[model samples]
Target: MVTSLLTFLSLTAFPPAGDHYSSTDSGRVRLASELAWESGRLSGNQYALLTNSSSQRLFNLADSLIKTERAAVFFSPEHGFGTNLPDGVHSTDEQYKGRPVVSLYGNKKKPLTSDFGVADTLLIDIQEVGLRWYTYLSTIRYCLESAAMAGIPVIILDRPNPLGGLISEGPIPDSTLMSFVGALPVPVRYGLTVGELFTMAQHQNWFPLMKDLKLTVIRMDGWKRSMLWPSTGLDWIPPSPNLPTFQSLYWYSGTCLFEGTNLSEGRGTDLPFRWTGAPWLNPADSILFNQSGIRVQYDEKTPVSIPGRAHKPKYENERLPGFTMKSITGDRSVLQSIRQVILSLQSAGRPLTIKPYLFQLLGSRSVEETEEEMKALNDFRIESRLYHFYP
Candidate 1:
């Protein structure tokens, strides 16, 4: 299927997947922004926009219908517009696509009433990489909260969750450990897309201000419940500095837990999460973890790559033997990966102490080998499927 960034959403609907999708089954979805504009929804109504660099292609295509004058101001999440900023840094306010861009990740994490100015609606056109730990979901919540307080309507131009709406992983975090990263009570890899999440949030009234707040989600044309990231026909733009490829995004589910440990998550290298190691790890250790259903091979040669914002990646330039992660399919569950990592750490090397922060990362107990912990993992997988907004 030849999918262009500017293509209008198809009017056609597809049937459920058979053994696999045929040429007759296609979901050439239009961006919600396009539907809104073409349908004259945003023709004259002023709005406040929450978007970033990734959506520029859509913005350019729909520019005739969506002018800067229609937006009172613009908002951006982490990594700045189009990932122009480095990881972990703040985005600065600037003019983008003709409107004044406000830094939601910088001085103000939430939009204030003053930020809305004269806008009556909040248009969300951002792309989400589909992890609760990722910051875009937090930005959406803040935008919704501020819009609710100001009594503004929010129209979400829904995008694919990239992970699709099927498989979810890890346990949900209890209220105590919740922060900017794990802001929601969902599992580490919650399956719902941004639009579905808002629907659930409003139905459950997750926020006090949104009880009567107006919410409209423009669903996509052809997207189905079962398609994975690669199936979408969209290019894999790096959602963040660390996850530069679809391969990296897939590997991230399990590998990201390395952040909680003392190991280097391949930050300085071109392949961040995919290349994990520490100066303490042994090359022979990769063989021990190979039995855990993940291929972990020690690299003897250095890979060429661009660095993120970090100038000094941990273990930079040193040929410390580290393992390369190779799980890029949802066929494998995250808890399975976590279990493998824990068992590998115990058997492959001397026992190590995990930091408390891991609880926040995995949204469950630290990677301990226990029956109760295992039950939590199973319960998370079974319970989270209830939140699937698609299919």
Candidate 2:
């Protein structure tokens, strides 16, 4: 059995220095769900799980809860219960393992009071990719709101931010620009784990109504701020269909910007988010990266219909010239890379038509404006540190 939170807290009060850590150390990290299960924290309560296939792959929390008769109902985020629905598609209510599964991404983005049924507690265990546009963060926020209004305690099983917690990039979203995609005021690449983000949310009054909500974060064991997904020794499961690999996720923070343009962000292709282009672009024109250990090479790709993943994706069935990016070392600055791509496309006489949706994605009017605002992140960085569970 795993140690109690009290014992774990005292042991991890002072994290080890970053230089002494090994990236290849398997089994060094223990998930909060695993610890919670071993310690029997989930035995007595009927839990309404806000989770997806990624969490199922990681620990099978739902199956365990059902096996022990502690599952009340299951909740799914943007993609659906099994994550088999395409982007922007609404998932209808379904049955999973003889229990009702409600879709939070359907007609209603938040759970109704009646949806709770017999559940006394709300448990969130979905994996997040550490980007503002990832809808899982918004789903969690909505669930928190529902839990607060319903007068129930919430348990969050903390997971590592695939991009790591060492760096944050881009600018905070304007209050007027807040939507399901840009729910929080944090930067595009906010460096906090899901647990830390919600903790900071309650403390900082991001959602003033949730201030009194009973929230408990079952913290991960041996996870450090410097450790990325690979460093944590956790298997990589695609949180969403598009982000299939770490390389795809690494480039997503920057390349996702293409979604607002006429260019294809590699959707319907095997390399979604890793490859970006349009038929109008010239392959001979090179895109440069200022960050070290980064390489961008010219290539050609064709997007096609992939039922559950992407259907009728942008410029589907057309071959287009694009560039693929790969990182040889650690995480590189994604904002800088975005700027570089913008300049390169402009220089190639293919000036991008700025879509209104781009502002929502960047959380700013333009890349240049966002870059200017990024100069003032020192305060946010410091303020965020107060809620850090790991060093």
Best by lDDT: 2
lDDT value, residue 117 of candidate 2: 97
- List the RMSD of every prediction in angstroms: 7.6, 5.8
- How do the residues 79-188 of candidate 2 rate in per-residue lDDT, one tens digit apiece? 89988877888987889889999999989899987899999999999998999888989999999999999998898888888898989888788799898889998988
- Lowest summed lDDT over 10 consecutive residues: which window, candidate 2? 14-23
Query: Model 1: residues >4 Å from true position, as ranges?
Result: 1-27, 58-68, 300-311, 328-331, 351-353, 369-389
Clashes of each: 3, 0
Q: TM-score of every model? A: 0.84, 0.90
**Tens digits of per-residue lDDT for model 1, 1-391:** 2243113112111111221112332555455566555556565678788877666564442255254467677888998865766667887888765667788898989988998888888988888877888888888998998998898988787777888777766666777878788888777776777887776666555677777777777666556668777877767777777777888887777777777777777776767778777667787777655666677667743423344445465555777667887652445675567556766786655545577777787776656545665576576565444434346
Backbone steric clashes in candidate 1, count: 3
Best by TM-score: 2
For all candidates in order, the CA lDDT equals: 0.69, 0.80
